[model samples]
Target: MTPAAVNDADIHNKLRKELAQSRVLLVDRHPEARNFLRMTLSAVGITSVRNAGTAHEALRQARNARFDVILADYLLDHGRDGQQLFEELRQQQLIPLASVFMIVTGERAYRRVVSVAELAPDDYLIKPFTADQLQSRLLRAMYKKKHFAEIYGHLEDDAFVDALAALESLLARSSEFALDGLRLKGEILNALGRYDEASEVYREVLAARVAPWARMGLALALRGRGELAEALVEAQALTEDFPEYLAAYDLTADLHERTGDLTAAQETLLAASGRSPDNATRQRQVGHLAVRNKDLAVAEKAFGKALDRLRGSSLRQLDDYTNLARVRIDKGDIAGARSVAADLRREFRGGKGSEAAESADVAELAALVVDSLAAGRTGDAEAAKNALNAALARHDSLANRRSTAVSQHLAVDLAHACLAQGEEARAQALLRRAAAEHHDDEGMIDRIRGVFARAGKEHLGEAMLTQVSDEIVDLNNKGVLAARSGDLDAAISMLSQAAERVANVQFLVNAAKAIFTKMNRDGWDEALAERAQGYVRRAQAKDAASPRVVSARELCQRVAKKYGVQLESAAKWKKGTDSEAE
Candidate 1:
């Protein structure tokens, strides 16, 4: 045999040995298919196998056990496909980047299945394939996974610098996975805010071939570098060329929204939702945009679909129920609104512990707003006022414990309630709080403005938003200026106060950065380091992937090393999961 053939034979022999010890999860809606796959794996001498009949079960299995490979049918039950499941698993970090995920689909869906941009599967199998074909594809995918193992490890640790080094090492050898290494390099550069370098990387790939992911990466790099117009143009071209690229549509919608064109944003999301109706997150975005654009019909449909799609899934959120009800109330459908409120109560009811009680309290708070709006529509002024007052009393205490998105929605709901009840001062305060907390989020700001417009206070809302923006800028600037002038003590004090007061991501990150700088300059104070760590945690809670958050983290790492202090894992600062970085 030739030398190349001998090398290939050796690799195949090694893969077969590894396959014997690999654990696999097979997800298919049909039991017969699962059995067939299990038999095939057994024939290949791979006896460690698990079966899941739905995406939910697949998620559960993946969460509880670490599998070497996951094979999922494209047509999963409950309106979720294998691609969606893969996206969720990656986004939630339930699956490691080192593992192999393969999609099994029919020939009809082969094109659509392979056209995914944001998160593509390791490999795919068309139906009616032989067991030999399955083994061949699995071995190839496993080989590729092994090739990128080092890079994946660095990414899981959020060590972008180390990841870049690994990528460089891989690329220097001109390996078969050179293009994949370039893709990962671009992603790491973008994540680290090195947008110019990322843009160059993508451009280099684009020059070689018209890869959809490269196009999308280039657009993202441009956007990160503040080249919004160019980014939008590139994204629009990408969507036109590859309409099934749902992530391109999302980027287009985001660009439109950032350009102050809410109507275009809504239309873009609506089109994407039409193409993929079962995407709950996209549906929610469509609903939010439609609500801002005063398209109650579309808002109701989008939110309803989102609620239905996520009903019993672990991904379900209270916002889905509240959003649908809010749309119903806006449409003057009091009965519909009350029906949704009843459903919310039922969905979150009857649990036994403190966690359950807290969930019930939040559900009740949401239901109260829905009921109040319904009451107002029915001309029950007294009942509306009473319920509104009750929700207002509990809003602050409850909102603080929720995610930023959830908290903002609750604030907007309460503000709408206040406006409807002629409590202008209360409404203003709530709106201001929302604006301050989410000053950088255009969607929430637009939603806040929508509430004022509904109450015929658009001009006042604009003024309040401007005031909030100025206040945040002024507060942030004081510390930034103090630091620039070498007044680290004052900068730390002011920035820390700003973070505590607003809890905005910018303020929190800046506060932590200032504290770290001070500690690095002078001797490390344990109390100050602890305080800085708290700010970093708060910033991560707000936006873990923010460039500012990353910078703060790097600074903290540097200072900790300088002081020879062992810090906690950066993964602990992530919002929900303590798993590795995405």
Candidate 2:
């Protein structure tokens, strides 16, 4: 807006052409500064500028209009900075996530703010820059925004697969833009459960700086491999450096639990919940852990807070409610659990409308089981089963698709109910199938084994453990030889086949090890081994340890020990280069 700059008429004409169909917001405290930006934008054939002279005016304009681009000053002459105002607009839903934010700043404070803020602005530029510099930065931001528009939209809509597809498309656009798109695409891939693809991207990014996100992502991938120690280290170190990176703390808790450090896991989660108090998911997780520890007061408080904050979020899971009910059941409040069960049924059946929400019937059934088990009522269990069947029958092909979560839950509850009625054989059959169905899900499988152990069926629990262990070992050995021969695809194929027959800790550990050896990645290996150990321990927690079980257990330990993963924290646990220890 200097006297030497291009005239307003030429700039205005440029803006008219550029922003004919777009909505733009311009906030500047000084009229000369405002006119300069306006003229600069106009010279570029952009129009549709809604001007605000102050932070108050910007907030007022945001309240009344929907803007596609926000061009604001970093140091506004108001109580709040642009960062605060930007977050306020976002909270009000007046600015969509896709809208580009450009900060015109001469202040040094904005850079420090940018370092910690999660939702980053699209671009920032110092004041008194040339028209060329502004044009370059804006064009760069615009291209990125335009290219990722579809993908961002899908993510906003919570259509994970669709967003994943958009990321993939963006990746394949051309090498010219792939570098910028790769990181985001990897994040989207992780969101979609494509860990292997995400791992590849993280590995590539790690060659530069040990990005905390990439480091944490690798740890998660390794945790999936049963590499608990390695994953734990990555998470812990990352958390130490970036305490504000709450995901690392959350991940560390999971690694702790995988290693049977329940107290450590609980502490980690509590700390994380404290750090990110506004995160509903983190609050729900704390509530869940509290319920597991039988701390009803803590569970109720956490769940209540989550329920209030995440009211409008459709993705807020029913786990918080279920855990609260569990706490009530443990406190000898059967009626409370029953009421919670009813509430679950209503929430899943009525309030839930997304595809994931459609999985509400499953929650309803679990709630019903919780209530029945607390009351020790076999008749109510049968009624609940019939109701679940009726509810599931309404969804077209829903049952077939959810053979994992829903099917096993049904079978386990039915077995628990049968046991209460003294139908030993019926209970055994139901439980056996349920174990097979949930062999891959370590959490659910442990819960099933815990039920048997608590019921005083020591021998049956050992037998089930033997069967599951054998299936996993058989699958693991099939990959073991191929892994030695450097036939990773063959190894992967064999292990995947084994996973189908049985879900076992040792098997997953081997699979994870194979992935590590072939991929050259970073994560916590000891954690993975601990998770496998947990499965075996749950089978014998309440009785005399088995001799044969110990023997097989040693063999599985040796397999992992050969790959830099010690079964326990023993000093003399190093494996030689033979890589062929039976």
Best by TM-score: 1
Q: After superposing candidate 1, which stretches have Cα over 4 Å from the reference?
A: 1-17, 112-119, 396-406, 519-534, 556-582
lDDT per model, in order?
0.84, 0.60
lDDT by residue for model 1 over 114-224, one digit each (tens)? Answer: 665335788879998888889999999999988898988766655567778988988898678888888889988888899999999999998998789899999999999
Candidate achieving the largest lDDT: 1
Off by over 4 Å in 2: 1-113, 116-138, 144-231, 287-313, 316-320, 348-364, 377-414, 423-434, 437-440, 472-582
Root-mean-square deviation of Cα positions for candidate 2 versus the true structure, in angstroms: 15.6
Give one digit per residue, the lDDT tens place, for model 2 in 5-85: 656456544544444456788888888888888778766656778799866577666656667788888767523356545
